[model samples]
Target: MDLPIETTRLRLTELTLTDLADYENLIMIPEISVGAGFNLVSNPKMLGAVARRQVTAPNSFGIRVKGRLVGAILLHEQVGFDYQPDHANLELSYFLHPDWWHQGIMSEALIKLIEELTASKTIKTLNAEVFSSNQASKGVLKKAGFQKKTTLIDPLVSKEKVIYQRALR
Candidate 1:
């Protein structure tokens, strides 16, 4: 799959197997994973598995800075979700390098991605599960026009998460 998404100073592409090392390092960062659904680096094979899965998944994109893969922005199609009964929504997720913090690169990539995906008519609305402590991501979603749809307790993580929604139109 040839995934390429461009922003003023960043690119959002697809994840690859080579990302395991970086993903491992990133997972170890406390700030990056706080309230994140996954814990610290304990599964490299799982990361590889996800990369393989994303190669065929239409909605997942790897965010890049200066042509280097830095993070990922993901989406789960509405059809297979347990929340299918809720008026057509796809779940969104993102992660970035701690080095990229406060650079506005994510905000740029996010807005561009939302615009491109919506313009392509791939999805009508976007939703996100934001961990309460991950304020950086929460702000990105809000700036990208996502509004709080609801809050739910993630059974797996046992944490309060916010469900944010945004209409493409």
Candidate 2:
């Protein structure tokens, strides 16, 4: 919920209504959608709707590189979905522009985010689901200290979804 979650070469901040254009461009890329699950952008109206919803969602952050919106991250509380009494299970999701892929920027950003969130003690667990074919995302989560828990066959995508979890304590 804070603005400008600063990393060495990037800034993570909340998405705003004006960021729709950048968000649209980022998610519409074929490669980006493949990993980020951007089916919500199949049509213009749906794209607009998803973009608008992103800006209003709680704990969604736009990742910026040198003042340009190049990616986005989200932390969602999974209420009643595998609930643990003492720990809040928050889902972590992120996407970076294809052009910025393999540059280590995303890994750095994620490490910084985990540090901040853990220090705050607001979230007790961080969870992520990555398509089995998404090697980069799998690597990012591992580098951020998340352990692979299990794999589920996602019917919609017809691919294995690797579930990763990191306890924030």
Candidate 3:
């Protein structure tokens, strides 16, 4: 998918190994991916392999700000937390460099992603699970139109993750 989606302040596109340097910081940070239930750091080559696989997954996108890669926003079709699918539903996941925080870059990227996904008929619901303590993530998701669905401690992800959901239709 040649996304190339753009907003006034953000962009969403497919990522390649060339982007390793672009996303190295956020993807490697334990803090960022810790709450999201997936960590990509430990090995650069492994992350590259994952990105390579994702390029064909049809479910994830690289988040860019002003043409520079800053983070990743993905709409996963399946997750262990819940074997749930609303036919066109997706789960929200993202991680960004601390440098991009507070600039509303994520907010913009998310809005554009939702609009694009909806336009493409890719999804109608977007669910997310944020660590209860991760207020920053909660705020970003809230800005993206996701409302609190539930706050149960995720058994699979441990007690830190809290579930949230958004319906696009």
Q: How far does residue 121 in candidate 3 sit from its true spot (Å)?
A: 2.8
Give model 2's TM-score versus the native structure. 0.91
Candidate 1 structure quality by residue, lDDT tens digits, 11-61? 877655566556556655676556444553358677556546654565667
Residue-level lDDT for 73 in candidate 1? 80
The TM-score of predicted model 1 comes to 0.79
Candidate whose lDDT is highest: 2
Span of ten consecutive residues with least summed lDDT in model 3 = 33-42
Q: Give the Cα error of residue 131 in candidate 2, in Å.
A: 1.2
Candidate 2: which stretches are off by over 4 Å? Answer: 81-87
Q: Give the lDDT of residue 45 in candidate 2.
A: 89
lDDT of 2 by residue, 1-169 (tens): 3567897799988888888888988888888777777773568787778878987787888889999999988887776645543336788889999889999989988998888888888788999999988888899999999999999998877889999999998
Q: Give all TM-scores, in the order shown.
A: 0.79, 0.91, 0.79
Clashing pairs in 3: none
Measured by C-alpha RMSD in angstroms, how accurate is candidate 2?
A: 2.4
lDDT of 3 at 132: 88
The lDDT for every candidate, in the order shown, is 0.72, 0.85, 0.72
